[model samples]
Target: MKTDPTRYLARLRVTPGYEKAVPAPPSVGVLIVGYRACFAAAPAAGTPIASFEATTPVQIDAGAATAMALISVERATQRLRIRTEGGTEISWEENYFSAFGDSGTQWHLLPVDPSSHGGFVIARGAWAAGGYQAVLTRSTLIQAPFAPAVVSVHNVDPHTGERRW
Candidate 1:
């Protein structure tokens, strides 16, 4: 049943793209409305280059709902993270906040070499590990087509911590 008007949330749109490797740090423009995070990728030296965006528009604000926000991309060694207004980064993977309940954030750091067939390191953390934790799962060389050479950071116990996914 519809409890209250402020108890609902909006939908999210995630769009991804591929382009030339950026050699330097990019001048990125990010927008975070409420708990939704919008990603805008640009050139290293600062240009409106091609980009991808994932909106973390779902968040539980002082209620009994589950809000989720996350970002994922293959072959990503480094990424630009979104943070609070005063530069307080949400975490490595994403930022999550809630007044309703504590689903915290699900953090996953997967080191994957899509072009190579080798090993992987997976580290993850979440409720099972005391609410929010980030750990890696290691694996040996994998030379399979469908098998991900991906080591995933499995779960997160809280809304903190960052990693090089």
Candidate 2:
């Protein structure tokens, strides 16, 4: 079975009093805080899974002025990928680690199901950047051994925190 790709809008909020300055002035910095997970079609519920308010934000060399979260979900597997300009690509997988707690990076595993898995990839990062972008790709099963994949891209405006699909 083949399924058409779907797009969903998502947002990232700056943690109150959690912003930090980058070593190189005027450039952008990022501190990622993984909060919770939920379905892309639904809203995020419950408290955050992790917190980075107490941790000091790390300075990274980024000039793009935007952070990105690349989420991919395929049969029995899910991954969250993060990247910024001049920064190394960071990734978290559902089955790989229990809970990541290092250098302000954190993530939660998605709930498992027989047919498909559902969850949202929530994270917070402060940067000189304007907004955050999230791209989600999922393979959904409509029949046994046959699944169709859909992709969703979401952007949030830093000024208004408005989500645009």
Candidate 3:
């Protein structure tokens, strides 16, 4: 029961290096294409799991080696997976978007750490209490093992919000 990766959300501007910056934010929405994976014996086993893919190619420097993109899976942990040039996959232990709409940032400051994972956050019109919403506070460039890329942003749907994948 895999879903097709066919939607275009937004054009994300990935900064350079590991340095952090809260530049002018972009209008936001989920970017990756979402899919639900079902096991052959799923009903007898457990619930089906969801997965997502990067539909848009990442924009990196001309001489950059590694490339990174933000993605998410329905009902799965908000962990990040980085693929190496040799095809090796490294998974990050943070669900960065887990606290987007937390009590602290209802209509105030919403801070997002690039290393965490969870529900995806995007810029919204109103400061709503629920849903995947947040302002781009800081984006850090993850180094080595991946690409020579400078920075990247994670945009995905909230865990408990309506499924847009």
State the displacement of the C-alpha of residue 160, model 3, in Å, after optimal TM-score superposition: 29
Superposed model 1: Cα runs more than 4 Å off: 1-60, 76-155, 158-165
If scored against the real structure, what TM-score would every candidate get? 0.17, 0.21, 0.17
Tens digits of per-residue lDDT, candidate 1, 1-165, equal 323322222221111221232122112211111111123211111111111122122322323222221222222122446565655333232223234333322222222111122211122233212122221111111111222222222222345643221
Error of 1 at 82 (Å): 34
lDDT of 3 by residue, 1-165 (tens): 443322323234423342253333344432332222222111111222222343222222223211212322222223445566545554433334446522211111121111224322322322112223221211211211222122223232345432222
TM-score of 2: 0.21
Q: Which predicted model would earn the best TM-score?
A: 2
Error of 1 at 58 (Å): 11
Candidate 3 Cα deviation (angstroms), residue 97: 19
